[model samples]
Each structure stands twice: as C-alpha cells, then as structure tokens.
Target chain A: MSNKVHRRRFLSQTAAVAAVWTAAAKTPCRALAANDSWGDLTGRLVYDGAAPERERLVVDKDVDCCGKFDIRDESLMVGADGGLMNVYVYLRSKVRAIPPELQKTVEKQVLLDNRDCIFIPHCMKIWNSRQEFYIKNSDPVAQNVAFSPDLDQPANIVIPVDTDATWKFNRPQRKPVPIACNYHPWESAYIFPVDHPYVAITGEDGTFTIRGLPLGELEFQFWHERTDFLETRDWPRGRLTVAIRAGLNDLGTIKLPPVLFAKK
Target chain B: MVFFSAALVVSGCGQSESPGFRINLDGYDPAKVSQAQREAIGEAMEEFFGTPDVPRVPQELGLDAERIAVAAGPVEGRADGAQHGVYRQHCAVCHGISGDGAGALATTVDPYPRDFRLGVFKYTTTRAGAKPLRSDLRRILLRGIPSTGMPSYAQLTDRELAALVEYVVYLSIRGETERYLVQRVIDEGEYLPLGADVKEEVFDEAAVWAAESWAAPEQNPEDTVVVPPPRPEYTPPQRAASIERGKQLYASKNSQCVQCHGPKGDGDGENDLLYDDWNKPKIGVTPEETARLARLYRLPAQKLRARNFREGAFRGGGNPEDLYLRVYAGIKGTPMPAAGPQAGAGGVLTPEEIWDVVNYVLSLSGRY
Candidate 1:
C-alpha cells in the first residue's frame, strides 16, 4: 500500500480516539463545583548541575538607543543556588477548580513590555482560562510585534514607542508562542497560555505555589524554554505526578537533572 | 550563468541528498513514526478531518475537509511510526512525509514545495482571502505544477488523482493537528506516550481544536470566483501606453519588483537572499544551532527566490485573474507584498495600476 493510504488508515484510527476525547469534554461533568473540596500544592525546581553561561546579545543596530545598557540573554537563565527560574509549571486536570482568592489573582491581563529593547518579564503566563496580551513598546524606535499562534488571525502588529496593543487567543495555545520584533531580531520572549488556575511560573528562588488545586493525584507539568529537545512532547524536563491532600504539599527542591539538557 | 553558479554554491556543501526534497519516497525516516501513534493519529484524523467528501464530524467543524480517496492498495508498517500510504510514492519526493516542504529533492526546486500546515494553498478559484475549492486542488493534482520537479500524472486515472488529493488533505490536516498537539503539550502537562488516563481527553480536546480550524471560514469558504473589475477596451496606442505605465510601475519603490523579480522578470534580482516570514523571524540561534535545527527539520537555508516570471510557472494559477489576485493579495505566507488597496494603508497600487502590472508581467512571460 502507498504511504498515503497507510497514513490515512492510521489517521482514521487515531481520529476515533480523538473523537471520544472531544465527545467527553463537550458535555463536561459539572458536579465538581467551586466549594466542593480544593487543595494546595507547592514545589521548588532546582538544577543540581552548574548553571549555563549567560550569553550577551550584541545590539547590531540602533546603538544610540540599544547601547544604553548591557543585555544578557534571557534564553538559558538560571537563578541563585542553581535554582531554575522562569520555568512554567501547570496542572493538567479535567476539573478546573480553584479557590476564589486565587481566581482573581490569576485572571489578570498579561503584560509584556519592551523596555530598553528587553522584554520586561522574559517569560510570562496567561495563567487564567482567559488569556490576553497587553504588549507595549518602550523603545524609542518602533517595535514590530509579531507572534506565532496556530488559530484565528495572525499576530503581527507594530506597537509604536510608548504605545501598546491588545490581543486575545480564541483558545489556549499548545505551547508558549514566541513573540518577536522584526526591527530588533535579538528581542524575543515567550507567552504560555493556560486554561486552569493551577499553573505557576517559577520565580528567582525557583519556588512555586498553586494555592488551590483540584485535590487527588494532582498531575503537574514542568518546563524550561531553553532545555534540550526531548523525544516525548510532555515534561520536556520535569513532571509531577504526586498525591496531594486538602492541606499543603511541598514536593521541595527537586533537581533539574543534566540529562534533560544533555546534547543528543 | 550567474544564477546557475549561485545555485551550485547554495547546494555545494549540502550532501548528495542536500536539497532534501529531491529524492523520492526512499528518503522517509522509518524510525520517527510509530504504529500505535500513527494509528492513533490516523484515527483522530478520520474522526476530526474525515474524508473531504463526507466529514464524520458536524458541518461547523469539518465542513470542507479533503476527502480525496486513492486506492493505492493496503500499505503496512512495522511498530515504528514510518508508513507510506499514497503520499510517499507520488508526492513525498517533493513534499516530505511530514508535509514540511523538506523532501529529498526540496532544495533543487525553485519556490520550494508548499508547507500545507501553513494553510495557504497557492492555487485556488475561491474568493480572495479564501481557501481553494476542491476542484482547484484536483486540477493541480492532475495537471501538475509547471516548470518544476512536480510531474504531470496524466497516466493516473481520475480515481488515483482523487486519492492523491484526498491524501494531501489528510496530510495537511494531520500536520496541522500535530503542531497543535505539540503546542498543547507545552501548555498542558501531558507528555508523549500519552498517559492512558488522559489520552482520550487530550485527543478529544486537540481534535476539537483541529476540527474547528479545518472548518474555519478561511479554510472552507464556499464562495464564487472573485472576479476582478473588467478592463476597458484599449486602442493599440492605449495598450502601448498602459504597458509603458506598467513597466514603470513594476520598478516603483512600492513595487520593489526589480529588487527580487529582476529587470526582465527572470527572478535573478538584486535581493535574492530574502527569507520568508517563517524563517525571517527565527532568532538567537548560533550558526551551529541553526545547522542542527536544519538537519532535524530537513530544510535547506530556504532563502526566498524571486519567481522567474518568464517561466509562466505561476503556482497560484496562470489565468489572468489569478495573476491579478497574486498581485492583489500578494500570496499570503510569501514575501510577495500585497499591492492592492485591500492591503490597507500600506497598499500602493490602485485597481487600474494593479491590472497594468498584471498585463506587463503576462507580457514578459509571453502569457499575455
């Protein structure tokens, strides 16, 4: 049989499973309510190995505006005590439930600013189910903002200096889409879209907290943007499949192994 | 002669299989694909994508899915994911099995094979800014792309053509869905060898997203021909004047025609090293890093080449209106800029000016 036929047959088989998943999610089980039992989950992701060297980007053009400050590469960033920073951790659960306190905090407009040719938060999240971007260009020169999203209209807009633009995704992206400036090739950042409230981006201390997670065998995904590519799609580096109860659960200070970043 | 040497230099360091898209189906990597994954992906494709003619899903979801069905006989595969159905035999040499425009003979072909996942079909009869009609796809399949490695399939029966078309649609949808899932894996916690518990759920979510995309108005528009405004009958002198006007317009700053398409429209323009939107935005990678990526991706440098308009190998279509639309919308996903007013404030060409340029381009290619 031709490869096309084989692929079709194969796709047909996979489509069946996909149909079931869609069919199930469409008519969601509303039984799990807000007040119906929530739990807290906290953890720290640290790299046991020495941190990678931070490369400085040379501002090729616009030296007057860009040459003001030294720019360190945000791409393979590591924090104090070998603590990994800017790592996005999200919980994958069908039941999207979070305490009211955390709900307000998570559902805020995500801001990504181009200050001195650097994206303010090198990494950010649309932690809430509702994800949007209020991108601003602080540089004197124009920053042509463009993003890679699979759905709807393409994200390409020129945000003039001191001005901002707003964009929203119809659905959560499969990965954090990279935002880039055409004018400044060196300026780039990633925005992760998440549907649930249990997602947290690790801070300088490499510590993270998802105040209210749907209790049970809470599943978590840990990802750092600069890690080596993996054979499997999920858990590019770290995965948390642990049981958490009604109270606090600290899966503390786990090592970010070198094998994950090992060159193939 | 200069262009020939340039081509040589581009592919000189490349291995025998340098322009990856050149070789036939023999080049497919049997290892990257797994049977279970293929079956799962295939099944998902069927449910979400369905045959183009009869989509298993709802109208709003998969209204315009490609349903070309070819009877290439029953193809089989080992536990590994590599399996060639109709695609590898006929199309994979030019378009990769993954449909990423990185086939074995890819580099040799000017204006690389279409990356289907971009969802931008060059040829179409539908309204401007809409997906091509099924007949458009069928026509391309049977007729074959002109002036390129793509060969005519006059020998293949219409049924075979249909199957090939259907498989291309299948690959397009499949590639798009895979990209979606990879993005999901980044956003969500799910990993490969999907957990038994969430496999169905994850597939369901992704399928829904995939179906919605396939069923989008842009992808499956049921529109009539977007005919251009009719041109006034011109006298011999008037025609001469229009062509003269067109010659100047082609070289205008806004047109930037001479920079890439060349003075004679032979595609040997001054700025030949242009990258498409996809490659242009790729940033911060060292040369070594880029090489590693290109190897994994099976793509050449993929610098955009100005079309040798003299060849009359318009990937969109050779019709006058097709040429008109090419100038109007400027072929989305390509470096070709939209010159018509529809391009908003940046648009530099008026309706009449656009037609003039169209006539001039046709004259150069001898298609006028």
Candidate 2:
C-alpha cells in the first residue's frame, strides 16, 4: 500500500515539475543579442522641497557601544542636491532573456552588515533567488537578525559579534521584506529578493541603473521604506511602464513631493 | 463538566449539515477578501481536501489514507467491535473537528486552545521556525501539556496513537494550504473559481512545502534536530562557580536575558509588552483599531509572557536538556531568540555557555 502511495506521489511530483518548466517557457522573451537589443535603465529621484532634517535615533540600549556611532534616521535620506537615497526599482513582468554579464550576478552573494548597532547598506537587492544573502556583524555587541519574508519561509537567527550568517529565499517576494533586529528596535533594513536580474537600489545620489534589460516595454515596481509603495501621479501603486531602448535610457530627474514622505 | 461534555457531543452529532472547517480570515483585511473570493477559497479547499466527515488525503502529502480513515468521521462501533472516528471520539471536544482549536471549551481555558492554522507548534524537538517531528507530537499525546486542559491519551493503543498523529499532520497541512491559497488569491489577484493553473502553481507547491517541512526532521536530523552536549558534573563549589558565570552571561549584552526574563528572573522584564507571531497581527496601529479588528477576527489578541524561571513549570519540558534546547533554539513565534549555534550558522552563546545559563535558570527555579 505504501509502495502504491510512493509511486503515485512520484508521478504527481514529476507532472508538477513538467508543468513548471512549461510555465517558465511561456514567459515573454525577446531576440537575444550581445549589443543589439540589450539596454540600461537610468533614473534619478529628487525631493521637490527642502530636504527634511534627518531624525536622530535614540540609542537606548548599549549606550557605550551604539551611542558613539553617528547614526541618523535612515528611513529617508535626501542628499544636498535633493537626490533621495534607498529607493528600490525592479521589474514586475517576467522576461526570459538576460544579458550574459548580468546573469553572473545571480551567483554573487549580497552583503548586509551590522556596524555600531546599525544595519549597513540599509537597503539592498538580491538579484536572483539563487544568490546567497550574507549578513555580518562587525560590532562587538551581539545582534540578532529577524528576516521575515511574505512568500518565502521566515528566519530569525542570531548573528554573534564578529561572526556572519547567510540566508536564501525559496521564492521571489512581491515587495521588499523588512529585516529587523528585535533586540535593538531601531536597527532595521529592507531586502528586495526577486527571481529576475533586473533590480536596482538607489544610492546617495538618488540614481539607479539596471545594466542589461531586454529592449521592450516592461512594467517595473518602485518602493521605499517610508512610503509603502513609491506611488506617484503618473505611476499607480509605483508601477512604472517604460519602453527600454538601446543604450542608456535616462528618465531625466523625477521630482518627488515632500508630502509623499510626510508621516501618516 | 461531564454534562457540558455530553451536551457538546450531542450538539455536535445532532447537526443536520456536516461540520466544515471555517475559512481563516484572521488578521486579513475584511474588505480584501470579497464574498466571491471567500466562496472561491471555500470551494478550492473543499476540492483539495474533502469535508471533515470524509477527508481526501492528497497523495503528495504522504499521509496514510488508512490512518486518516481510522481517525476521521462520526464515532461508532462496528459489528466486529472495531472503533472509528477516533479523533471525534476523543479530541474534537477540545481540538475541534478541523483542529482549529476553537472547540466548545476553548474559551473556558485561561490560555485559549492553540489555533494550529498558523502551523506554529510551541513545543517541539525540532529547531525554531521548523515543524515538530512525528515523535514530538506522539510525546505530547502521551505526556500531555502539564498546565493546559490537554489530557494524556496514555491508555490508547499504539496504533490509535499513530493514527491521531497522522490526522494532526493532515489537518495542519490542510490549514496551512488554505492560508497559502488566500495569499495567492490576494497577491496575484486571481479571478473567482480558481482554475487548473492555480491548482498546479499555488496549491501543489504549498502542500509539497508543508509536507517537506514535516518530513525534514526525520530525513535530515543532523540539521533540524537540537542535540545538547553532555552536562558537566559539578562539585558543590564548582557548581556555585558555574552558576555565578551563568548569572553574568545572563545579564551580559550577549544574551540580554535580563531585558525580557528580568534581572531577577521574576518574569517582570522591562520589555513587558510582547506578543507572539500569531497574536501580533491581531493588534492594530492603535487601541481603537485593535478593538475594531477584534470584530473581524473571532479570538481576541493575547500578550505572550516571557517565562519566569523562578516559577518554573516549563511547557516544553522541565529536564536540563529541554532547558538547553530552549536556550539553543529559542521558543518559536515568541521573543526568546536563539542564543546557541544554529545549523550552519553562528550564534551568540557556545554550548558550554548555554548549559551554564541552563544551570543558572535551574538554580533560580530552586531545582538545584
């Protein structure tokens, strides 16, 4: 009887695997070329008004260790030129073909470190589900990382001082998942894990670049920690539909109003 | 109590319509899942796993249909004197027909009966965020949770016990799958009357993932199982010294045991306001919002208390090894973080240090 059950299970599992492959094959694919159709997306997010003063985080615990670090509010960071920091932009639609160079990033490990009781690289992008997400604690004080993803399995493990830990997501998440430290409530970070390689996070200059995307119309999602979804008048639910052309496709200086970042 | 129990059984059996598992909308925005969407979810669940009276065990889940058959259905004796409806006969009064834990007597208990829909078992041999082993469930059945209304089924035959264990797993998988389908429907915005595409893409994957989590402990014991190192025998003076060391580590920033467990282990931790993963969602942005959400979710949100070692009636087990595992893996869904090394990952405390802390905790409980 058990044998019969096993055989039936094996058959069903095999069918499921076949179905996944067929589904994968159905995704939109464009003609592959080294330099022909491949293009880069460049965009900048600027604050419409004067940059709000960054709030100073209260170092309640481990004052001797955490208080020394110049830790300001990381939820929103606008530079001198009004360039916003830590805005995530990623492809929503499925695309099969990818440039060879960008494909290599799937194997690379993305690092998120803890220094002076603060999560370094407050915002990060995990290019592909296959890539390992590594976390390190450079501080002398012990820190625990609570990684809770919406779709994937959640993990809340401790990262001892000077030691490191690694996590891997089983599937892509619809939105960036918050990585928080329960011990130190203020220590927080966000990780955007997607299956596709077309993902980027804005730097201090408020600019982001996705090296090689298929030259065609694709829907992309924009997200920020403060604002749940980077919704705009033009982009509903932060869904930006753009046509990727050959060479650099620069979306010239998109201005975001200060009202968007106002506390709800 | 006897009359109440009898009344419950009569009420349960007297129903004209068959009892079905409720579609868990707990912690979900009531507006998000429309009436039509709810109907779709109900239909999909029914299609995959039949009514509680007659279960359709998915082959991929590796559940024994014979075992499930022995456990499910209305209680009765056959001509041969063999028993059926083992679960309904013994457990349904408390565990409920669907194992939702909202039984007739659920509210009467201090700590409400555990809603297994979340798939978070508090006591388990497996590590944090992992499913309990079959053995772990069997152990609970035999010994039972000490302070809770859950009574030991020690008098039952091994076969009957085995059947109950398998049934629990089945119910858990079914419940978890229901949650997965709800998420898929909301996230993907699938139209009503979910099609073959959903069955293939969403339901199958959720079932397989859940089944695998249950199987992982047995399949890969090295990674999932927590094995405590041998406790070093201590003389009178040496034991005192070890306890002193543990006391320091407990207060140290490395463990931060004082923050939640309190400096005196009196359960009056500074951070008194704590909720487990299960109850956290029920809490809204404000008190008024929480009160409003209480209407949506039937059960009221309850705060989780960090264990007071001084009054030690450990839920998992009171043995030194159990304490060692607690400090090692931490309790799942609660604030207790894993201090000892996890599988393939570094941790704050070493095995020896964890044992020391365990010793300190034991001493606080006046066990030493």
Candidate 3:
C-alpha cells in the first residue's frame, strides 16, 4: 500500500513539473539585464523639526466618554509630516546600461494595495527606475492623497472608492519626500530619493549601517523633508564628511537636536 | 547360612538388584531400624513394587526435627519514605501536596497558576494543551521560565525524578477527574440519562450541522441600507499624482504616524519593546490567540488589533471604522491617546487631514 501511494505521488509531481515547463516555454521573451557593477549607497534622512500637533484619541466603545477625544501635550511626536523617516537610499550606478540579470529583477509595475482603510505597509522604499508606482484602493470608502516633493515635478491625485491610480516621476531629485491620505489625516509616511542601492533605513532604534564601500572619500548628499528648522539653526544639512578606508570604519553617532514647534 | 547369603548376593548381583533380601520374621523389631534405612526401604518398595503408604512431608516420616536449624537470610527492603519525603519538601510548595497546583502562590499572577487539577497543561504537543507528556513535564521542571518566577530544579536524582513523575501523574489524574465531574455538573445543569430525549441537544446538533454545511456568506447588516458604488478608476496621470502625494505625506513630520504605528507598519514600534502600562515586560500574546481574535473581528492577523478597540478592553479593536472612531474619538480610562481635534480636544489636523491619517493607518494593516 505504501509503495503504491509513493508511486502515485511521484507520478503526480512529474506531471506538475512538466506542466510548469510547458507554461514557461510558452511565455513571451522578455530579456532582463543584470548589472553587477552597481554598488550600494547608505545614508540618513533626518527630519529636523518637532513632529506636528495632532489629536491622539483612544477608541473604547464601552467607555462612558467613548467619543470624547484629547490632544497630546508632549514635547515631540516622532516621524511626523514630511519627516523623511525610513528612507531607503540606493544607487542607480548604471541607469541606462541594463544588464540581462538586473533587467529581470526590475519590475514593470509595483502594486500598493490599500485595504482595511490603511496602507498595508506604513512606509515603502520604491526603486522606480523602470515602472511607475500603481496605487490601488481595495476598500469601498473615499480616500484623499497628499504628497510632499523631492521629485523634479510635484504630483497630487485624489483616489476614490475601489479605484486604481498610478504616479510617475520623470526625473530624480535628491530629496526625501512625504505622502499622506488626507481623508484620514493621521495616516502618513516618507520616501527618500536615491539613484543607487547603497542606502539602508534607520530601524526603530534610529540606527543605520551601510557596508562594503570602495576605498575613497565619497561626497554623499542627505536631504530630509523636515529640513526647514534644522537649516535655520545652521545645523549640518545635506552633506557628511567621511574617509572610507580599505577596511571597516565606524562612523560614530550622528545627533540632530530637537526641533521646536510654535503652537498653532 | 553364610553359604546361603553368599548365594543370594551373587544371584542379586547377577540380576543387577540390591542384596537386601533378608526375610527375618522372628527377630525383626521396628524400633531397631534407623530412620534413613526405613525411608530407603520404603522408597525402593514404592519404586520396584506398588505400595499404598508414602510420606509427603518430613514430619510425616518423623524427620520434622531436622527443619528447625535452617535460618532464612534477611529479606530485601526499599526506602520509599526517603523518596516521598524529598518530593514533599521541595515540590509541594508550587506543585501542592496533591500536585493539584492550588499552591499558596497560585494567586496574584496575570496568567493563573497551572491548574494541574484540570490536567490542561500549556506548552505541550498533546491535544488541546492538556496533560503534558511525562518527558514534556520533566523538561519544563528542569528549565523554568526565565522571566517568570518559576525556577529550574535540575538537582534531583534520576531515581527520585522517576518516582516524583509517577506520583505527580497520580495526583493529576485524581484531581482532574474531580474537576471534570464538577465542571460537567455546572455545564449540563443536571445529569441526564443515556440517550435522554432533550430538545436542546437536538437543536444544538442541528445548528452545528447547519453551520458546517457550507462556507459562511458575507454579512450585510441591513438590506435597506444602500451603499454607494465604487468610484471609477483614475487615469495614469492621476494615479501618478496620487502616488507622488502619498509619498510626500509619508516623508513629512507633520503627520508623525510612523512613531507608534511603525514605519513598516509591522506594529513593532519603539514603544512596543518598552514596559506596558501594567509594568509588565511587553511580549505580545501568543500567535494562536491573535489569530483567533483576528477571525472574530473578520480581519487579517497582520493588521493591528485596532478594530476591536473597546474602551473596556484596552488592547483590541473590532473594525476599520472602529479604529477610525477610536483615532477620532479617544478611548476612555486608558492610555491610548486620541488623534482627532474635535470634541474640544486637541484637533490639530483638520477633518480632511484626519481622513488622510486614517487612510495611512489603514494602509499599515493592508486596509487601504
């Protein structure tokens, strides 16, 4: 009995593999270029201002004041509007020179699904070297869109219920951008501009590390959407001093002082 | 007479038989015969010829005197008291004297003490987390929970450990049987006869079968309630603009949604690693419980537990609107601060901005 069952399974697996191979053979030829020469770039995108003031409400249906709300009176709200937080800075070393392997990995369309009335991933690092980003609304509710610019051109489009939309950037701008849904004002996130793959995002602990750099003094630009207050104070903006040695080198802690916000 | 005796012996030898064929009837006295000689004669007579009387016991043959001098070696004994005493001293404090887990320290814990009385042990491969396998129990006992107060007891001897395991199982079975009976009484109200005619039992079985018959259909709260149809798809240029806008809003500190919700929307915010409101180290509930609650709320487990967020229940929420309402209207009697400026509260973001924030928050859980 056991031998019979095993034989059946083996036959089924072989059939499935054959079907897959047949399907692959029928697929149209789309050549993918692989570029091994492209290197990674890593840096921090800082927001130099205290986070914006917003009402933080707790929702408890059983409470006596279930609908009652309050504003937080804290000194700071971390990673607020246009904060340039969790930006993925990468290198686009060979922009037009597409290698076969690299071209295959470049997706023609990237989908961002909106379900449960929120962005599935609060933040996304898109390598929009090829296809434009497609925003999809899977819910049956109204939604509004807001974008802050680090792109060469500013784009803002409102998305309605159960609709799909796309946003395209014609040129690269070396600045971190912000995006939000105005219908649900509390929903917000950040995007960083990069032409390379060498960038890494600062984790929840606000620490980022990038490794395997060629030995040299490389000039890197760091831009954040919340750069107004920091620039005014003459704090370091858009540039870091580093002498990359052949071996591992530790770039010590980078600190940005608290940005004060005036009461509205 | 000598010549006759020699002739008898020679004849007996020739026949391969003993030469004790004396028939002296005149001078034969029974008392004169030794005990050994009488026994041998009796045995030979029984073997060679059929005899009626035969001795079974030594006393029956007047040889009971020889049995008094043999001494029996010391009998083997076991030290069961010492093994039991060790368990009572070391284990009774937490395991209880009867291993029912109603020890003095059972109370005042977030998760109640492991009630061995029910034999429903957690952290086991057994069915329904009940009754840890013997080896499973030993592993827990040897390696106690690091953060909790349970300490490891790896010092017990192999023999002692074996004895303790048996005793624990005995106590658990006894207590669990009692608990099961009591629970049955409470649940069933009264004991019914086998195959009793009960309407409730029939109705319950029918309901179960009906529920299992097909996949559940989506619920529509009200047939009369008219929902607006979905909007038309945006043009390529319009969508491109929306993505740009979404990206811009994400980078700005004006929203600050990424602080608590997490940049990746994985819900592992910096605050998540810190101590919770109850001063307990924050390790979220088990994945199984989370999954069960998600099913109840009709949402995916990856989404935040914001849907079922009732004021009384500080941790969970029920729906997208429910979380939206919580964000708009703060929870009462809890630390979950509000995010809307209405109700004379700090309404920093306009109604439109709140909607945007709602969209962003929903997006975190794939609700957007």
Best by lDDT: 2
Q: How many residue pairs clash in each candidate at the backbone level?
A: 53, 0, 114
The TM-score obtained by model 2 is 0.85
Give the least accurate 10-residue stretch of model 2 chain A, judged by summed lDDT: A18-27
| lDDT of candidate 1 over B63-103, digit per residue (tens) | 33233323221232324643324555677667765567776
Model 3 agreement with the true structure over A1-264: per-residue lDDT tens digits: 121111111111112111110011111122121222322233333445554554453322212222243423222335543333443333322233333444455566656665554554554555557656677766554344445342132333444455566666544434445665533433455555444334555544444554444434553333333332123232222334344443333433344554423321
lDDT of 1: 0.58
Candidate 3 per-residue C-alpha lDDT over B16-124 given as tens digits, one digit per residue, 9 for 90 to 100: 5321212111112334333433333333222221111111121211212211111001111124433323444455555554454435564433333343543333333
* Worst lDDT 10-window in candidate 1 chain A: A17-26
The global C-alpha lDDT for each of the candidates, from Candidate 1 onward, is 0.58, 0.77, 0.37
Q: Fnat of each prediction?
A: 0.01, 0.35, 0.00
Looking at model 1, residue B207 earns an lDDT score of 44
lDDT for model 3, on a 0 to 1 scale?
A: 0.37
Instruction: Name the better of 1 and 3 by DockQ.
Output: 1
